[model samples]
Target chain A: MQALVIAAHGSHLNPDASDPTYAHADTVRETGAFDEVREAFWKEEPHFREVIRTLESDEVFVVPLFISEGYFTEQVIPRELRLEEWDPEKWDSDGTDASQATLEATDVGKTIHYCGPVGTHDAMTDVIVQRAESVTEDPNVGEGVGLAVVGHGTERNENSAKAVEYHTERIREQDRFDEVEALFMDEEPEVDDVTEFFESEDVVVVPLFIADGYHTQEDIPEDMGLTEDYRLGWNVPADVDGHRIWYAGAVGTEDLMADVILERAADAGADLGDAIERVRAATAAGTGDEPRSEPEPGAGAGD
Target chain B: MSESTSDLEALLAAADDGVAFDGLRLEHEGDGYALETPDIERTGLDEGALRDALETVPAYVSNWQYWQREIRGDGTARRAFLRRCERAPLADDESADHQPVADDVALSVPERYDALANGIDREWGQLCITVRFVDVENPDGERVYDLWHVDDAGNDLADLEVYDDPRDARALATEDEDGRYRPLKTAPTLRSGWAFTGLSGQELVDAVEFFYPATVANWHRELHGELDVDHWLETAERQTGIYDVIDELPREAVDWMAEACCVDSQCLRRREWQYEEGDDLEVDGGDGAFPCREPCSLVVAAARKWTVLESEEERTYELELTTSELNQLTDLIDAVAEGRTDEVREADVYDGANRYRARYLRAKRFDEDGNLEATERDGE
Candidate 1:
């Protein structure tokens, strides 16, 4: 049986930050594809590992519901869950796979499949492009203006910045933007390069992040040199220098994300194989020295 | 004690008789008691004599009001949920302005309603009220016009005034064209000292009804003076009909061919505000033009500057302060700080700004002990 676990990087400081995680949890649950589905958080309650203990599933699929895959997916989630990294068999004993044990260190036997964060997914660019289209009165494809995919890049992980870089190239492929550039807070191809790389008179930048936190609020404006109003729902015009740009609210504001997770759950059903064993043993023996052992690790497996 | 009553009567007789003891009378009963006039009615008692006279009465101590003021230097502190109510019975004496048993506020649909009604209707655009002249005359001093408009939540919207003739009443209801209804401009111009007045209560109410657009019907008036109740009610009803007819007039059409401007209430207000603002001498972006009549501009400017709404909301507001008020806030603060106003500290209210916009006002006196003493605010 295959089960699914959704992990979110929530904030302890804001009660509103957990709203999306809880919303998506309900979304995935409505599908009923996995024998069981649960959520874990970087912050707030039902912690990342304890969530796994409660599920007790042998086969579990972990999905990162974050904007970037760099530090959190590559180092942070692995450090917390105690599981092996993807393509572990390919790595030689150069201390590469040695750190992979943290990804899977539970009393119960379990096989986990971790998916990329949703922001790194192909479908997300459509949402981003759709968001850009909503703001401008007319999106001139012929104009050589650049679409800068700005994400909250952190020094903590190389993998996180790759997601933004990949998404930027995919966006450029659509040709609405003649030039597509990826910028980061932690890594290079930075935001300062934007004005230098700006090809046309007009520009529209979208901040690819989970929530409108510090990076989106203070840092982005500082990077862009906006002194006045929070540039929401309004665009900047050229001759105004940086005024030739506008912003879309963080992608988490999309109302359809709840539907996306529900769809992903339906596509990920692997049917529980371990729960069958527990049920058969209970019928055959009828009585045992021990009662049911803390819902076997793969109890949520097999829809 | 019974002889003391007789003695009191004898005191009046002795005063009339010019006998000695100075208006004092004595009775044979009750061991020869003496009587005097009530202390309130004293005419000839010297200050010292009055004190001495007051001392003679044992336990004649009368209590007057006193205050237990608790002032903590720090003082930082809709509706429409009614279910049901029975209809009120008709008033026994509707014409009586002073309802004897009712709360004094019963006389208030604003006590200034009379002054406002007959004074002038300076409000513009959305606030067009009607004015109709009624024969109903006020008994107070000048036999002023008894004008009323709408009924406010509690009292009638009446504006009474001592007019020389019908012309003064006519001057009040004249339309102001250069005020709030200027659709071409996003920013509203400032206005002041403009009142929208009507000749009669119902006429003003009808004008208000036309601008506000409500289906109102019943009309009443409470005139204070020697008019009979029958005439008061009849006049109140007549005021209603005439005012409603006046409300039926349409807004004046704008003429593009001619450069001439017709002054409507809104344009008039803006024009008036512009004249007043000219005196500030420092409104050239240093303080940003105060949108005296434009709330949206005021609210937005405050919002952009303040982290919390209250900080800006507390900005001292000086609506149409005369040259005198401007002096009082700035010059008086300077004078008081320099100990120039120490003799009596006559009470006044003035809003102060932090070199920026005035946020709020502090009026009324605080004694050296910080007790609020009664203040006489002498102003026009």
Candidate 2:
């Protein structure tokens, strides 16, 4: 059994940005589904290149801890890891091809399963709903509360905005809040236009970023007229206009995503049963008793 | 309540109502509440009692106002003000504790220097002092002292006044201007070069290291041939857009250049013909001449290397794979790195695989010929 590597874009300036990613990886490692679970970052150590060199396992599952399938996923990641050839134009023109969606192990000599970005998963809507519900003083009382899904939309790529829009629709379908609005840091509808989106007195903004980096920690708060030191989860309630704005942490850090990550691995043809059995056998051999079956799904999510 | 407390309360009430008690008056000047009681005898209280009462009244009033604001509106400003009050020494405590021990205390020159240094360190927050010895043979061996006012982070805030006489510097340290100490200027400068006549290189380095601990660490790193990348990067990141390469000079060198001659080729000082014409060769100093903006040789060399490093970029990838698949990928990469193509089986041509092959071949070719050009195409 090989390792499950979570790739994240860590920041040099902000420590809080990459903390959640490592915390989530630790949770998934505790599941005993893979031989090892590790975190590889772009900025911080252990750097992605350095991490690969240290890996003992040949078969690796890499789950991008990103919000969208854009330049990073299509060009940068493959180029760095020596993955198969990919045309950005083709992928951009008509989304991902079903045949090329999950890279087969036989094709690359060593099996490397490239899963869809964790943020783009269908299960993320549940996480988004939970994040929105967590910040509201009264989740049941939706009278004056609005949910705003904030994403890092780029003018360079329409897919970035589309991913945010997809999640917005999913969250809206749940009908948990009075109103749900999709907002972007770049391009329209901008995050600054948040006030005009709803007539509600309370706005619960759930940042759809993978990490709580500079954009989530600093830029978003500043743009929304909130004071600095506002953090992930329920922040110190900021007064924008006459309404109370509550900001939640990035969506990818949610506990539910642990299950999504496993699902992603399973979709990429990982044998979860075999990995679980190997762990259980190793534990039983060491302790002289059978270990608990797959110790709960969200074990390491919030840590 | 004590009799003194009751008397103080009554005095405060009279002061609040804008009423004059005896010959003294308590009035509100703008936002500040002040008691104008220059003559303590006119208030029918002893000098000590009057001073105590005055101190207690303002704190009580301020506390009352703080609470009033908290109850009526958001208490952000009130809370901050209260915090400031808590941190600041009370008026009575300052008066009692800060009183000088004696006007004339006979002390040796060394003792006086120690006392002055201690007083400046305690009163002016963070301060760095450098003393340069000059005219060692003269009866009164002259020395120039440079004092740098620094912030809590040890970042230089200002170049405090230089002094040739230790007595004059000590007097400035002990002087209490108005009720509070005089604040240092907001901007920093390297002024009045302290020239030493006979000090060796090691002695000068030791003197600098004593004042600035960061410089000591920098010196240690230099001995081991290590660059302080963080410090260099911090200076580089401050500038925006396209800037002259000279602007990227190391901060210490820039500071040195500002106080010395222009190293820039275009400068009149660098041109020998300007000196030949009996032109009083001008050195870089003062506002207009300081901070030579032209590309100097030192700056040009550093800028060339900096641009190369800054231009290169690295990317990271994230992939998902089954347990067995990850192991095989590892093997494939290892085989390629070691030039064992026979061990490296052909995988389906994908973006990652193709990229890996090119990198592997490049490395392999480089190892074989000691140059990547051996594998490069005609125009490439």
Candidate 3:
């Protein structure tokens, strides 16, 4: 069956980064729709490279949880995974079985196809809007309240902050916010530099970053002075900035991340199969490059 | 599918010795081992030493008394306090068995900081610092403020916040949906303050002292955590010759500060609080001049500590400071320039951060007319 790999910008030192991937993988596994599902991270274990060769399903789908279409998604994961290119230019215009045959001949799985990162999807706007709504009790999200859509913007790449453009645009189209603006931890529209841009004293700072660190703790508070009282801690368990300012945890820490992976698999055209035959095929052929004794059925496949 | 981190933590606790996470050999699976963190390293040890080290933790975590009460009186006395520590010193026989953290000690702050700060000095990579403001009510007869500081610059840290106010403080969550911040809310009535307890080296102390007590405390700390320590100096029990909490003390005392200051107490004014976001320099090195090579955002080196002090009479403000050793070197430089090297012996007494610094004679060279040219930098 189709297996979904939720790739993330994970950290080993801090558990918060990769935990979302693990948590969503658990939820996706519980659905039992996919024969296999797993997580891979840039910074932590089950790294991007080894995780790909370990997948057994005929059709494998990868969905990056990164918030930007920057270098990581465009260059790093592709080079490391050895994934076949998805450019349609090499294909016959008639949409025939030619490419499939070419892939099969080249020893690339005919069923293997990759979709873009889930972060780039239009559906993610809904997730952001929902997250904003979830922070407030009422569905009324930030009426006259300044919603600072905080992104980990960097001067190293303008495109790093450009994702905020897409997010802010999509979020605005949904008509869910009273005032929505973009702020960065590093780049222009720098969070601290333009806190008044939101125009509302009641500002909700949402980290579009995968995991929280200095920006959330020092930069955000030092600029806003919202948490001058929360000394010794940059992060205060989702609540410490006071009601005048609300902060949503990093966007990847959501339950619906698994849904995004499933959507990516559908886009990649995953081949679903009965559990019995798939398990038998995976065990007999040996899913890993080197053959190993069979696992005790479903043991450790999801990790 | 079954791998939950909490489940892993529970298993780590239950196992007799080190156990692989999710029963997968990490090295074979191609990821370096992920089951350890130096912060919780003590949890991995045998029972007895683990228990003894852990016993000090709850108290350390729950209050700031250990930090602010660091017994800063006589020089030899301070050394004795440090040698003794807070909890009983690890028995000499048990010293070898003490594995203080949960992971390999390589992840320890000092070790990591050494590696990272070395890189910074060598101009390798940028550094990041995580500053946390931890305020816990030590209802065990004291109220103290603590700042938990971590950085890429190795284990050189500073977690020093003392509540001069005699009031107890605790964590509270107030949620207002319409407000900007969420579940972790402070009472609009909550007022407290915090200060930087440590600096990079003794060189940075004077600048910190000048900036914080002047700029940040007036604007922030007086509105947030501890009232000014200067407030109770003369009026506090130490000055009144009162060894009592209730009898002769002023009405607004929150908790007794164990140390007595021999300074005059004065009435500190409470300013009207305002926080509309200020204009910016796009700090955090956004210039691409010095970019972060890693995917993570590189942070600057600074300790960010805050405290919330609530009061019936006094107001709280925020305090933020950074410093460096003022120029004590030129005296020695002048000593050499004049060729009278024997005067170098006098320069040794200028210990700025060490609580004693000698006032060096100011240097003023005469212009065409012999007069005070204001060319000398004063020493405190």
Candidate 4:
């Protein structure tokens, strides 16, 4: 039997980090695509170290429910999951030139296909565009609306910014939105100075994050002048400097993420088999062939 | 018949007599065997169908198969501990008279299984366990379990913080009822008002590990004779850095240290380690559910300080104290050791450990530098 393991960076302080992972696993489980759909987390129980042993399936597809291909995806996860024994120190000097291809390993009758992080998938461009469009009152985002794809970048891993930059450039190529800018929470073109980089009065900020924990709920909103009180929920078209900052939920929380995770698994050579048809049938049955609306930011947006 | 088949038939016959084997009931009715669990009931089942039902229902299968094959014999301690957690009937002749004690309600087999649908609450240390049988009709179904702080067991899910990730249990386990940070995760002071709901078997075990790290593994090891216990002497010898001095502590002082730190009041793990190999300390190791295989990091750190204090040469000093004051000191030590210092009332002056009594003793005996007026250490 085939099993799908959605590995994520959960949080001891915040349960919201692993929420979306569970939701996606539940969605996948409903499809009867895999005999078992399990979730593993770096900071949560059923940890990466022991998660694989809990499954009964021999063929397992592990999809990292992360936003980028950086430290965790390359080093910490691979080591903890026993996917490989790589020196973490070499991760930086080795540079981003390391193969971004999926890593597969067979041990003790189980074959684990480690797929790429869902955030870097090509289909995420559509997810982000859909998210940006779903939030704003403006029917056409191209008519003067500026889009800022926000990522939590760090100097520790230069590749962290690449995913956001890649998707930002990809969206820019479509030339659908009036302007597209890649913003970072940690690095240059900070999300805090978002209005300074965009001239459009209507700016849609979509956090390129896997979960809506501290960053999406507090940091990004606070930085964008969305809320001063540091609250839990946010209303759209938040006024900042007399301009509308239409803040969408973290892009990873989008329902299409179920599709994206499956796509990533498929790209990793996991035979979708009848799961592809099941996903289509589920999509048709649930959403009725319409584009998904913007999701509310909070829990179940896997951290 | 094969031994396994005979055992299955024996189990079936036991169930037929209305014996509920950990919430599973199989009865030989007028037609065929009627197999039932908390979640599903398959009626008109022949011997093969009954076997199929038993093997398919995870709650039943995991309980019986694991119990019969592993827990019934000279099984691992972890398996035995798990049996205790489920309130399963004792398998050995040593406890032959002991049976699973149910409530006063003498419900029928079907009614009994139905009663378990809401979950059977059990306590493991400070954790409240709720074992739930989810969709047992499905062959690949699971025996989902939820873990909450024992204090939060009665709280509604809506009123309490609901968590799905087991890792989040660390945060809940980090503090006490009064919000003070508990340095020891297994200090019997795990904060309440949080629950990890709908966890799989592995997730349940993982969450328990986060709350009380290595308790399950260590307990299993100790039971299987695989536990490598580092006693006080050996553990102290291995210590380096500032803790290297811990080896200098007197053997009797080590006993006091165990008394101060390893008991049930201070830690929820039974102290399995002693002063040295085949050498037991005079102090009573706690009766905690799990065993402490070695001195924890906290114990080692505390032992270093204790070693330094113990190294000081003993000195005699004359002191003036009333009989009441002398008794109050003993009361104060007892109160502090039992974590009841807060319970001593200021108004209750008659009680030796009362706040006002303690203050009176301090006022009369303590010097300005917070030292006893008539006493000084040898160095001083």
Q: Write the per-residue lDDT of candidate 2 for residues B1-380, one digit (tens) a residue.
A: 25334444555555545534222355544553455533322234443554465654433333232222222222122221122112211121122333322212233233323333322221111234343323323212122334443332243333333333222222232212322221111112212222222223223222332222122322222222331222223334332323335344544543443233333322221211111124323443223111211222233344545555555554443444446445555755655644355433466334233456556545644455565332223342
* lDDT tens per residue, model 2, A4-76: 8787876544545666676666556666678757666655434443344334356788887876777666665
TM-score of 1: 0.35
- Local accuracy of candidate 1 as per-residue lDDT tens digits, B94-169: 3334532311122111222243234322222323233211222421111112222223212333422333222222
TM-score of chain B of each: 0.17, 0.19, 0.16, 0.70
In model 3, the runs with Cα more than 4 Å from the true position are: A84-111, A229-243, A271-303, B1-380
Sort order, lDDT high to low: 4, 2, 1, 3
- Candidate 4: CAPRI quality band: incorrect
Instruction: Give the alpha carbon lDDT tens digit for every residue of B1-380 in model 4.
Output: 25445556656756566445556667778898887766888899887788877656544544454454434433333344444444443342233343323212243333423544666677778898886556544321135678887777778888888899876775676567787766566787777777888876556775776687656655555544555666888878865556779999998998899988888878888898999988899888888867776677678778878988998878878788888777888999888878898887768888888888887889889989998778554654
- If the candidates were sorted by their TM-score against the true structure, best first, what order would they fall in? 4, 2, 3, 1
The number of the candidate with the highest lDDT is 4
lDDT (C-alpha) at residue A74 in model 2: 69
TM-score of 3: 0.37
Could you tell me the lDDT of residue B306 within candidate 1? 32
lDDT of each: 0.40, 0.48, 0.39, 0.69
lDDT by residue for model 4 over A1-303, one digit each (tens)?
A: 788889887765554666678767767766677776777776564566556655556778888888777767776677656665344443332332222343444222367777667887777787787677667634346668899999888766676788888889989998887889999998888988888888889889999988887778888898888888567555698888867899987887766578778877777676666554454344322323333332322222221
- Sequence-dependent TM-score of model 4: 0.55
Off by over 4 Å in 1: A56-58, A84-105, A108-110, A134-145, A186-188, A192-196, A228-243, A255-303, B1-380
Q: What is the TM-score of chain A in candidate 4?
A: 0.84
Candidate 2: which stretches are off by over 4 Å? A86-109, A137-144, A228-235, A273-303, B1-305, B308-380
A27 Cα displacement, candidate 3 (Å)? 1.7
Model 2, global lDDT:
0.48
